[model samples]
Target: MRTLAATAAALTALLTVLAGTTGTAAAAGPTPLAPADLTGSVAVTGISLSWRQPAGGPAVASFRVYEGGAVVRRTATTSAPMQYLGVNTTHTYTVTAVSSNGVESPPSAPFTGTTWTLGMAPQCDEPAPLTVFDVTSSALSVRWSVGRASPQLALTVNGRDYGIVPGTSLRVGGLTPDTAYTIALRRANCDPRTAPVGYATTRTLPGATNATAAPRNLATTARTDRSVGLTWPAPSDGSYVHQYAVYDGAYRVATTWTPSATVTGLFHGTVHRFTVAALDVAGNESEHSPVLSLSTAACPVLPPSPSRVTATAVTASTLRLDWTLESTAGSYTVLDGDSAVATVTDPGAVLTGLAPASPHSLRVVGSLPGCPDTPASAPLTVTTLPGPTDRPVAPLGFRVAQPTVVNTYDADVPLSWTPLPGLAYRLYDGATVVGTYPGNAVTLRTRGAERHQYRLTAVNANGDESPPTAPVDVITPFLVAP
Candidate 1:
């Protein structure tokens, strides 16, 4: 009887274990369907993954997202925002659906997605070209095609990057005038190779400062037949004056940095009204100053001086004086000492009857009708050639005059003689030849209270000397102050 009881207890324990196994097996739920139509889009910060709801399966309670082989996210909606993803990195994603009973479905085909950095480029259509217009000294206006608008797009100007607000056009300010700028359209997360670039220059604006006052005290400083010199006090505000403009009547004749200018190329003997104005660097000009009326002196005014005088073609009894004239309307007078030796209308003249080897002082004066002679030109001293030796003659009228005081301790004896044309005269002190001259007069220097004897001879062109003239004696006296 005890053995029978033991078999029954073992059978009951077996049945209890079978029933518990069957109950646990019944608690397991049905499999769900995989997500379908998986797709993704990239943004500057992250990527957005989306899928269509799976159909014809156990009721889906949620979705699971797998990156590579690891599960990364779980969501109840059809879209997933993968935030804080790595930039420029490819992420392999697959979606699976979970049932209400906690049963899971097989993952759908892998759907690859990528996230972009701030400057990372995406594989997409390029945006339209940017349009730039309304450029000014400190600002500019820009616009672009409407279809090209994107949150990741930005405008770069002169190395400064700017964000695009919600608008079709943008105005950039704080620019500089007359400066070149590089303008580019870039996507925040775009490839550098595809960034659209352009160039533009800003326009310069007129300055605000204007020269307020006219030049003061405009007056003529000098006047000539063809030119007038003018001067003025710089404008009280000199900083506004870039230059001074001088005007004759309505015509601008000169521009100068100082307060003075010369107006030239005017008609002689005519009256003119002159004025001055100040010009600023921005090209703004002040009002003209008070008028200055002046008349040029009449014609025959001292002609311009002659220049470049030269003695050429010298001979025993003649020489030619060549000079340059500033004007051709006047005649030239050749002078010896204070006397007029010859007159010529041309620039050249010849003086004849000059003693041989005689030094002569010559000058030229320009004369015009009804006008005083021009000042004599600078003197040109020249000597004539001696006569032929075969016909040499002694100087005549050789005499010595009374002594005259040369300085406090020196006296000069005046010697005079008749000069022969084309002959040089030699003066002697006692037996020694003291000096030679081509002229008729000479002075001998002597100490006070001295006695001197003088004689004269003539020299020919061939260097032959004539017989000496009779000797003349003179006694120099020292003067005593009373």
Candidate 2:
């Protein structure tokens, strides 16, 4: 019994020694070494693996490629090309060498390869070809092609299969406007377990109508002695209206891009009628809107006070004022802080030589020949924009320095930049001003693992701002380590 046990132990030791051999010997022909530098190149639906034979290895009889411990291919050469793989799939493989006596070496390191994704994957025919030829608000036309003739095929829309479609082309209707859809083509008797032969995605067009209807809510917005200001809503037919036509009875007086227009050069003490119509981008004209009728003021009538007064700063040292009157044939005066700054015959006046970054109160007064001047309109205060000259320059060398941890989820990010004399700074996160600092540095508190962009602008005493500096990005960590 002892002799028999010794013989079995010696046999196990011999097998262990053979298994541990790394070099291939010509005399004994032990198991060869694993192939080295095993690498893979992937195609649309395939992967090819290549390797170099290890040094000191015996002449290889064949090479085996293993996937998940199963031999998938055996090739006599150092390279193997595989086909018919799943699209956009990742596959891992290892290579091994086989000796002439049917001895297999250990597997090489794993190599991962991914097949081509959508867009690069081979389309229709081999995969099936589907095309969307026409798209409408509620319908679309689709055509498909196959390499071989099949008696019947199926059309699947959004996972619902319609069995046994007759031809390669189909007109699908009853779709919702501005909706997305997924379409596929398959064999009529295709197995539920397999993928479709062809698939595509598309969106239906939005609903629209012809702009042939008249505009609504026509009215007079302002009135003057010789002119009428009119306004109306655009046609509500989901069509783009690029221009409008103002009409006086049968005559076209003016064309404008806005919904409002003013007609001038009319006689005082006269009755006038005005109407508006909309024009689409395709130059299609809509029916005329309802008419608005009013009479202009006579010569001896007292001028009415200006209404709807508005003042806007056009530049650092200029402003524009507009107002409406019951009769516009009279003279008008614009007042700035109780001082007459302009006198004009029109409803709009531009005032120049004003101070930059300063606020002023404005109003308008109207008067006619042989009539008393009308009362001034309510005061409107407006501030001018920053001037072009003598403003601070943009910050120099702006950067986000190191961050100091505040807590588990918060940190204080330090920002530094070169300072300018007699100028304050405004720090902006995107378009929002986050802080105003008199010095060159500021610390901002942030939370989460988020990225933030910052820009710096210099502010002068008049509230004029310089051009913003280039933006810098900073990211904060989700957690702080002790």
Candidate 3:
């Protein structure tokens, strides 16, 4: 019985010790979960790996990524990107999680990635074909096709690097004139050895020279009121002429590519002097050619003076002047007692601000473009009608005459009203005045089958017009064949 008690006590003590050890171990460090869903991708120069955070485990303090048994990266996040790897190479990666207590979990499933070759670099696949043109004395144009959108390229000219440019072409300027240059192109961030090589050399052009020969045979070809035209022969010297500069007097009027040019904005009947000089492409101008003197044509003559001038007093202070012109006139001027009373474009004008019952001398003149004032026509002498002491009585017996005949193209109708001595009558067809006459009768012609309404008014010396006569509607029949 003593030996059994001793063995039982030892067993109890051993169980207590084992339990204490287990508790201590659990407190010191927590087991972290393994990373899940490992994924990787290959880039031009490196590989990138990612994984999902393990669930149902102690919070991870950091992550570790491995590549083929080698620790490639360590981070506190679930992603790892490694670079500067061999091109066209394949790699394997795995991820693990570490707990805050410094305990590590098992690694994630292996993921493989392959680094891209230089040919797979962005915008480097099937590089653009190169071209060189616009060879000049101091500039060259280099162009290439961009196989991809937004391509960036690097260019080198005579050992000078023009850091990465965005477009597929570039113009190299400020170069030595009449000299050769070596040009090269490549893709951005690509190894010189791996990128396709393209090179060219510029050809030299002839050096520029001054233009020393003036244009010859300069003469006036045409002249007008507002412009003068000139023509000249090209310079005989070997230098190329890019343009010709024409001068009117001391002012440079125009520059033209051809030998002929017109200097505009000149005055009629004005004399102008012109000279021309030849200019080269290099901005060198030759001496001026011989001075050419030319004169614009004289101002045009005015239309003939208005004829058959007649003046009649419409009121005590107003006189109506009428005239006829041989041709159309641009404008007309009416003069009373040496002063311009009215200016009109038509042949007739009304003169106002005159004395009542007084004699006035009136004249009319016609004008045209470029001719401001024409000579005054023959004077017309007339006495204004005397002002009436009282309103005149209305005329009586207004009627249309008989025998309204239809001509080949028009109808002729005669109209008459009771005569009022010393008074003028105005005849109207609708609202338009057909005629003004001292007599009481008038005739009118109109198109066939057209209706005509006639009315008459009597005007006194004081410009007072009586009420219109009764209207008479007249329609003429169409002309019959004879």
Clashes of each: 6, 7, 0
Q: What lDDT, from 0 to 1, does candidate 3 have?
A: 0.61
Displacement of the residue 265 alpha carbon in candidate 1, Å:
12
Off by over 4 Å in 3: 1-209, 300-482
- Candidate 3 lDDT at 259 equals 91
Error of 1 at 101 (Å): 99
Question: What is the Å distance of residue 377 in model 1 from its true position?
Answer: 3.4
Candidate 2: list runs displaced more than 4 Å.
1-388, 480-482
lDDT of each residue in 1-482, candidate 2, tens digit only: 12455345433422111111223444355879888656655664467676655545564555778898876765445556665464445779998887656577889988887665334433333344677756655545566554232435677766766556543445554455688889988765546555677689999788743345667788887776556788887656665778887765334567899888887644345455565666656434455565566755544233346666766665454466766654333468888889987666556665544555678888888875555777787777776654544556778989988776676556689999999888888786643568889988988887534456677877777555665677687765434233
Q: Which digits, one per residue and each the tens of the lDDT, describe model 3 over residues 1-482? A: 12455345433422110101121354357778898656554565566665655346676656677777876665544456565554445778888776656577888888776655433444444455567776655445666654332255677888787666433445444455577788877766666565544577776466553335767789888887557889997756665778877765334578999999987644445455576777667644465666677777655232245555656555544456666553334567777679866566545555433554567677777774555655678877755444433444556777877635454445567777789788988776654568778887777765444455666667666555565666677764334433
- TM-score head-to-head 1 vs 2, winner: 1
TM-score of 3: 0.26
* lDDT ranking, best first: 2, 3, 1
Candidate 1 ranges with C-alpha deviation above 4 Å: 1-245, 249-307, 313-315, 325-329, 353-359, 368-372, 388-482
| Candidate 1 TM-score versus the reference | 0.26
lDDT of 1 at 315: 46
